[model samples]
Target: MSTTKWSIDTAHSEIGFKVKHMMFTNVSGNFEKFDASIETEGDDFTSAKFDFSGEIASINTGNADRDNHLRSGDFFDAEQFPTLTFKSTSFEKESESDYKLTGDLTLHGVTKSVKLDVEFGGLAKDPWGNTKTGLSATGKINRKDWGLNWNSALETGGVLVGEEVKLNIELQFIQQ
Candidate 1:
């Protein structure tokens, strides 16, 4: 079989995350600008090669102040490390509609191997006759592991930000 290429449909995809704030409520955010690509043998994702990236400057959490703070040296330091990236090392099918995706995630100048759970959302053809596939992936990572250790001690006794960040990604790829 020959390799097939797929490019992300940005309009239908999002790279989002959630983290606990003040040891209580969860704060949600997402990158407004991002891109991804995948290459596989035909339509089999079990041995696919995936590459994804998100610009630090595009981080949006609804509040301008917080977004600016995240781009500062205390967190992502957008000036020094402008983008976070991921390159897959393995893609293994776990079931009919589920798979395990392992990759090297580079963020805040640090690179670490991370694993995510992926659910295949099947495929479909658009009105334009373009073939597309959808995927939903979830994962968790410790911010400190990627050198995003900035935090403040809350007056109420807990920390201002949680260490663990939950990843919630939705991807739509157009076959090319």
Candidate 2:
């Protein structure tokens, strides 16, 4: 197998996250617009090239007010940053189905190395005769590390938002 180029099927993909809110429950959200391109030597993903970009203003949490707040400087500050991006640094195959993917994630003017556990979901051909593949990546990072430090102090006890932000990505790619 040679180096194959793949384009993300954004319609069938998702970039989402979850964070602790108010100290008790989790607030789940997804980015509505994102783009990714992948290059792999045949079916071997152990070493590949991956690049991803997500529009910060397209965040959806099902609440208009909160969504707007997220777009403000208190959070992503979409006007200034516009987008969050990731460029792969390395991929290490650990087991038959597990891979540790390390990448440079840039958000809010901060770039940091992040690791994700990627699970190759196999491949298949669609009715349209297109070769497709599935992948899922999950990771976590401290929000404050990226300069997204704005938060409120609850009068009762703890803070309003937690530091850890959990990331979950489900992607489908079609060979192009």
Candidate 3:
């Protein structure tokens, strides 16, 4: 197989995350707008490249107040840092279906190296005769490292929010 460029079908993909809120409950949300591009040849994945960029202002958690807070300086500061981005730096194959993807993640002016567990979801031709591919990835990062450390103390001795945030991404790409 020859290497080909694929554009992410954002309408069919999702970027989501979860964090511990109020010391015990979990708060989850998804970004409504984002873009990604991928290049790969066959299943070897040795020559693959991946890039993703997301709009911070598209965050929606079902509550306007919470969403506003997330976009404020105390958290993501969407006004100043309007975008979050990631670009693959390396990839290590662990199995036929699994891989470790290392990349630089930038958030709120902070950039850090992060690793994600990637699962190849195989490929197929859609009803429209378009070749499509699917992938799912997951990872965790400390929000404080990204300068998002805003929280309050709880009477139970824990902070209002957890420092670690879990990211989940499900993407579908079509040959372009």
Candidate 4:
């Protein structure tokens, strides 16, 4: 196998999530610290080895109180978990620039298989002659499945936080 190694360009990547807040609007946040890598057999990403992890303490929502609470036992419990991670199990190409990636995602002390839809952004050459590529991955997971069950019954009717969490990952990798 002609395996090629690539490292994530952190400055060009972001890991973000959104969930329904209350029942009307959605609250979004992102992890400020994350790392990922790619190991492919060739130029084609049809099948590749991918892995990633993000610091739980780096959760940011533009609100310090909520961020701190997310790092607490009521949510991520950063002291005990410290980080969230994903290790790919399968990577299947959908047509030309589309793909489906299945992996094990661990969060808040629980591990579960999840799938992400990927859109390849193609490869390019940087000003310094480095080979770089970009892609966007999207997925959804039920927060309760990962033990993040903290919630409150709103007097309006529904719970405070929604169960489904949407994940958005924008990644750029430089060929190593």
lDDT of each: 0.96, 0.94, 0.91, 0.93
lDDT of 1 by residue, 1-176 (tens): 99999999999999999999999899999999999999999988889999999999999999999999999999999999999999999999999999999999999989999999999998899999999999999999999999899999988798999999999999999999
TM-score of 2: 0.97
- Order of all candidates by TM-score, from best down to worst? 1, 4, 2, 3
Clashes of each: 0, 0, 0, 0
Off by over 4 Å in 4: none
Better of 1 and 4 by TM-score: 1
**Alpha carbon lDDT of residue 61, candidate 3?**
91
Better of 2 and 3 by lDDT: 2
Query: For this target, which candidate reaches the highest lDDT against the unseen true structure?
Result: 1
Model 2 misplaced regions, further than 4 Å: none
* TM-score, prediction 1: 0.99
In model 3, which range of ten residues has the least summed lDDT? 39-48
- lDDT-based ranking, best first? 1, 2, 4, 3
Greater-TM-score candidate between 1 and 3: 1
What ranges in model 3 sit over 4 Å off? 42-44
Which candidate should be chosen as best, given TM-score against the real structure? Answer: 1
The TM-score obtained by model 4 is 0.98
| Predicted candidate 2 versus true structure: per-residue lDDT over 66-166, tens digit per residue | 99999998999999999999999998888887889899999999999999999988789999999999999999999999999999999999999999999
